[model samples]
Target: MKVAVVGGGPAGYVAAIRAAQLGAKVTLVEEGELGGECTNWACIPSKTLLRAVEVYKEAAEYLQDLPKFDWKAVQSRRWAVVKRLREGIEKLLSMNEVEVVKARAQPAPGRAVKADGRVIEADALILATGSVPAPLPNLPFGGKVLDTKSALLLEEPPSSVLIVGGGAAGAELATLFAKVGSKVVLVEVVDRLLPALDADIGRTVERELRAMGVEVYTSSTVLSVDDRGRAVSARLKTAKGEIDLEADYVVVAAGRRPNPGPFADLVKTDERGHVVVDGQMRASAGWVYAAGDVAGPPYFAHKAYAQAKIAAEAALGRKAYYEPLAVPAVVFSDPEVASVGMTEDEARRAGYDAKSARVPLSISGMGLISGGAGFVKLVYDGNSGRILGVHAVGRRVSEIAGEAALLVEFGATVEDLALVMHPHPTISELLVEAAELAVGKPTHIAKRGP
Candidate 1:
């Protein structure tokens, strides 16, 4: 069988490699870089800068005198990391014997694609064109206004930045600039930050950002931006009243827009333009598939890998399907946040009779030693005693999300988690403690009736 995959991003590349491994001839086409936004600009570069800022922040706490950060050096290292990872993906594709074509590929009639002024036909086609930062209305990109992608390519940090949106991307960028001595004001239109996660988690992250000197304005929107050569004056409408916010630059991290490219007619799409796929990652058309950011929300590269594998296998006449019980969502902010499965409210809304318990990281020896303040929340079904979700926030909590995902996947109960012995003086122990509290047998913290 011959397979043609469009967009050599996390989804398309993985699909190409997987199909090739299944003894199918694969051809991968990408308009730009192989790793897409996740590699070239979004995830890798942003996190690289975040890590550097995190290190500096941590050191500043202990040492009275810390050396000033060199933005150029950090940018150089960011490029190096991205280049190395991109090369690794290229080598992987080469080893898998997948033919890669670099061009803007458009879907041609009848299972064929048009790229580089030629038509190539395949038995099956996979669309994984990924996404771009959604443009903010009225305030267009360029000059002093920047989107997330353009913000990443900045040669130097701006003197002052007004970030419009308080999601993961906005929060991360706010943290980055504020830590590097750039005055930052993060404005969110919603009542809180990270509206996708639990309300408490958002509140916790907001507190952490404030402690780092980031001015957060929730329930606010950027009305207009006036670029006057020297500075940009933004008119912001808040719940209270309207005010002018001046900054060296205005960054819009409003979210992302799906890019199915010229193949939009081949698949069903949601109102937000995301491609809709079935359980097996199959599109409306039988011979076509879609994955990654183009497929839908909770957009993570790891999720794309799973979808890619399923789409590839199914395309190869295999019995593979993508039906995951829980997909972890992680926000790598100062006090990192991670969650899997439903939130307490979500479980209750789903008619699960949900009960929740929270154990503050302060109670754990590791959390206290690490000098971070956050908590672990465990949501479970009261009737069935099945774990519904795990939400964590604090230092290194992102690493604990894997175990939390496993529990949610296996439908592990409070007792099941409490019975597992976690090592002493570690953040992992907080999971056990939270479970104990949920089951009405508190270990480290005082028991509260759930």
Candidate 2:
């Protein structure tokens, strides 16, 4: 089958690679760079800048204890880190023997695609056109008013920034700027930051942001942003009253919107313009499909990868389906934030009769060794005693999400976790303790009742 993937993002790129591996004739079309937003704009660049802030923040914050590194030296290294990775992605697709077409694609099902005034036919068309930052209805984007995509491209850190939105990107960037010694004020319209995480987890994350000297205001709205050439004036509505914020730069990490507005009739999309896919990552029509951020909820790279594989395989006449038991959500902050499966609220809302256990990693040997504030939370079905959700926040806990994620995938109970032996003084050890604590026989249980 001749497969053409639209969009050069994680979903599209992975689908192309997977289709090629499956012995299909695959050609990928991308409008901008090869790696899509995740590689070029969204994920990779944000983390690269965040890493710079991590080093800079730690040295300055822990000057007496930790060895110092020159801030200018670290700042100088960021361009090299991001540029090389972007170039490396371009090389990888070429190495895989997949034809990389650099153009914006207009897809016609089971027919051909038009890009850059050229036409190409394919047996299967994968639409991974990805997303762009959602616009604030009252405010426009320009001047000192920037989005997360533009924020990463910045060479010098802003003296002060007002970040709108409290999702992963907003929260992460706010913390990053604060760590880099920028005065960052983050405003979320919701009741809490990281609304995707459990309320408790969100609370903990908020505490961490405040500790970093970030001005976090929940239940707030950015009424308008007026650019003043060098800076911007933001009219915000806080819980207490309306307030005006002075910002050298205004970063909007609000949300994202799916592309291809005209294709909604040909495909499935939710009310908010995100593509809707079935269990097999297929649309209402058998051949039409969607994945990645465009596909709606739990928009993460790993989820996109899994969805792409299923979408591509099924498209190629395979019997594959993409119903992930656990889709890990990882936010790479200083101490990181990782979550899988349901939140406590989600469990209760679903009528699972669930109970939860929360354990601060500070009590764990690994937390002490890492010299960071870390914590883990496990939510379980009270009747089935199966693992429902796992949340961790700490240094390197993002990497350790797999350990707890597997338990979620396996429908494992606290008992199931007891059998596995985690290495001592490691981040993963906290997951086991959290699971054990949920069952009331934990070695490091914090409390008796949930």
Candidate 3:
């Protein structure tokens, strides 16, 4: 069988490689960067900048004299990292014997992809065109109004920025600029930052952002923006009523919609233009599969990677499916926030008798030594004692999210987690201690009264 994967991103490249491994002739097509948005623009570049900001923040207090940060050098380093990783993807595709074509691919007549004025016929086709930023009405990408792509390519940090979304992307960028001495105002239409996480987790992140000097205005919307050359002026509607604000740039991190590209009419997409796939990652047609941001919500690179494998295997006549009970999300803020599985409200809405417990990270020896302030929250089924969800916020809590994901995925009970015996003087111990608190064991701190 021959397989053709369009959009050489995390999903497309991985799908191409997987199909090649399954004894199929694979052709991969990409118009721009082979590593897609994650490597070229979004994930890699943003994280590299954020990491530098984190280092400066960690040392700012301890050192009396700190050298000024170099924006050009940071930009150079970010591009360098992107270039190396993109080359690595290219090498992997070559090793797998997948034909790599650099061109914009369009759907051709009958199971074929047309790219660079040539058609590649295949028995199966996988669409992974990924996504583009959702544009705000009246506030398009130009002048001082920027999308995520343009925001990262800024020559130097802005004197002031008004970020018009409080999602993970906006929050991370807000934290980055505030630490780098830019006055930042983060506005979210929703009631909290990181709206997808548990409420308390979002509140904790808001606190951390304020600590870093970011002025956060939740339940706020940017009604309009005017670029006056010298500065951008924006009218915002908040709980306190409408107000006018000015900044060097207004960033719209509101959200992203699936690119779909040339495959829009070929497959079924949701109202928001995301491909609607079955449990096996198959779209409207059996021979046509979709993955990554083009596939749907969550829109995570790791989720795209997993879906790529599933789509490839399913196309190869294998019994593979993308059935995940828990997906972990991490925000690389000063104090990282991570969450997996259901929130307490979600569990209850799903008809589970859920009960939750919280253990402060400050109580742990590692937390005390590190001087970090955050907490671990565990949501479990009160009736069956099964773990429902795990949410955490603190330094390096992103790493702990993996274990939380596993417990939620496996349906581990509070008693099971409490008995596992986590190592002493570690961040992970908070998970066990939270579990103990849930099962009435009380190992780390005094048991809370019912």
Q: Each model's C-alpha lDDT?
A: 0.90, 0.80, 0.91
TM-score of each: 0.97, 0.92, 0.98
Tell me the deviation in Å of residue 295 in model 1.
1.2
Model 3 residue 402 CA deviation in Å: 1.4
* Model 1 spans with C-alpha error above 4 angstroms: none
Per-residue alpha-carbon lDDT of model 1 for 1-450, expressed as tens digits?
A: 999999988998999999999999999999799999899999999999999888877888889867788889999999999999999999999999999999999878898999988887999999999988887888788899999988878888998999988999998898899989999999999999999999999999999999989989999988899998889999999888999878999999988899887888878889988889998889998999988899997779989989999999999889988889889988888788989999988998999999988999999888987765899999999998899999999988988999999999999999899899999889989999988887788977876544
Ranking by TM-score: 3, 1, 2
lDDT of 3 by residue, 319-411 (tens): 998999999998887678889999999999999998998998899998876657899999999999999999999887888988999999999
| Candidate 1: residue 317 Cα off by (Å) | 1.3
In model 3, the runs with Cα more than 4 Å from the true position are none
- lDDT, candidate 2, equals 0.80
Across 350-370, the per-residue lDDT of candidate 2 in tens digits comes to 999878878888878878766
Cα error, candidate 2, residue 184 (Å): 1.3
